[model samples]
Target: MKRITVIGSGYVGTAVACLLSTKNMVAVIDTDKEIIHKLSKQISHLDDPQIKKYLKKNKNNLKFSTELTSAISKTDLYILCLPTDFLVSKNEFDTKNLKSVISELTELDPKVPILIKSTVPMHFTDEMNKEFNRDDIVFSPEFLREGQALYDSFYPSRIIFGSKKPSLATKIASIFKEAAKNSPQVLFSSAAESESIKLFSNSYLAMRVAFFNELDSLCLSKSFDAKKIIEGVCSDARIGNEYNNPSFGFGGYCLPKDTKQLISQFKDIPNSLITSVIQSNEKRKKYISNKIIEKKPKNVGIYRLQMKEGSDNFKESSVINIIKKIKNHKIPIIIYEPLLRKQTFLNSKVMTNFTEFAASASIILANRYNEELNPYLEKTFTRDIFQEN
Candidate 1:
């Protein structure tokens, strides 16, 4: 079995480690001691069920460590899955963490082929290769969803490798393909093209989300049947029927940052739709906030802080934006999220008891409808027409 080293133990890293460990000896390294401790006990820090199962079953082949030097020394194939958060002030991605990992690896002189699974700015991989004076680095974009990361990794839609060396690209693809249950289509292209593919792909999905949210906004203003209109429009074969569900906005780890990053890359280029997509999402959130304000509830009860179901991530979540807007209007608010252990969030009281939370607020704002809110459906305000996340 191939000895593979995966850096980072977040969503993408954990999923990749679990998938690869089924057939290869995988070492998962992260700076967080608590995450390392959890993984060492065959416990997954991520919320993905598939990842937890795989980690439990494949503990024999998987290794967890906080020491990067030791892990890199044992494996020739390295995968970097570090975070590259988008910085709004700089209008660029903060890739310092990724760069640090690469720097550490270079110092250790593993000299092995390194594959980047993190989403980065266009031409970043190529520039990094030149900066390090190494051609063995590759960029392979990951398209796994937050809640179903491992499931998506085990059955990828497509595999694209960005590498100048065909032999090394093939070897990287082989490892993923052998681990994946489905024989996905594999494509090799330049690093720049691969980066553009990732940015454009997520931006397109964001655009679709904006389109549906705008449609919902119009229906709300004109008092039209949004569900009927969506049904009729999506019935067209050309339009298809995916990503049409409406929410507060397209706020998640990928969509918001990717859309903004794509817009930032459009410098000197004539583009209207790309820039407007970002604006539309912001407008959608404001509209949702105003609608809640019109109700003039005693206290606004937030059903959940997460962006979607089965996910614990609240970073860049649309509901949080809605909460801020409501707070700005001098309205009292309470949050009900089981995932949060703290009694307070952003200066607002967090209700651990569901019954108390539901009873305190005269009206509730739910981004996505859930069955638990059924008894209080009349008091809930939501734009979830399809009841899907």
Candidate 2:
């Protein structure tokens, strides 16, 4: 079996390691001792059911460690799943961590192939290959969601490899193909094109979200039924009713940052739609906040902090933005999130007792509807048209 080392045991890396361990000897390396400790005991650090099952079933083939050097020495191939968070102040992605990982691996072994699964700016892979003087540095963008990471990996819609070495690219594709349950279309293209594919793909999803949200806003203003309008509009086969759900805005780990990164790339070129997508998302959040302000509640109750259902991530969740806006009005807010251990978040009180939280607020704001909020439906304000995240 092929030996693989996956670096960065976050959402993407953990899922990749579990999926590959089924047919290959995989070692997961991370700087976090707690993450390594949990993985070593066959316990998943992330909140994916599929990952938990696979980690348990493939415990014999999978290994976890905090020692990167030792893991690299034992592995034949390296997959870098490092973070590249977009920095708003710099108007670009902070790729320092990814560059550091590449430097370490090149020093360890220059001949071993390295596949970059981290999201980087366009032409980043090409520049890095030229800098290191190696062609085996491939850029394969990940398309997995936050909670459904392993499920998407097991049944990927497409597999793309960005490499100058066609033979090496084919071999890398073969490895993923062998691991996946279904035969996904594999495409080998230039590093720049592949990078553009990821950015544009996420940007399009953000745009669709913005489009439906704008429609909902117009319907609300006109006192029309948004659900009926959306149903009739989505009836067109070309539209194919999906992702038409309204929310505070499109805020997640990928969409917000990826769309901003793509806009940064349009520095020289004149474009309105690309720039408007970012503005539209912010406007949607502001519109939602304005609706909350119109209610003029003494205390507002936030049902959950997550961006969507089955996800523990709240990095850039739209509900957080709404909370910030509402805070500016000097209104008391209490958050009810079972996942939050802290008593206070962002200077607002976090209520562990759901009954007390519900009684304290005159109105509640929920980005996505849940059954737990059923008793307080009359006091709850939500824009979840499809009732699914």
All candidates' TM-scores? 0.98, 0.98
lDDT of 2: 0.90
Residue range 280-351, candidate 2, lDDT tens digits: 999999998988888888989998898888788888898899999999998888899888889999999998
State the C-alpha lDDT per candidate: 0.91, 0.90
Error of 1 at 38 (Å): 0.9
- Give a tens-digit lDDT track for model 1, residues 1-389: 89999999899999999999999999999999999999999987777788889999999999999998777567869999998899988999999889878877877864888999999999989888888889989999999999999999999999999988888999999999999999999989998889989999999999999999999999999999999999999999999887899999998899999888998898999999988999999999999999999888788999999998878899999999999999999999999998899999989999989999999988989998999899999999888999887
**Candidate 1: which pairs clash?**
none
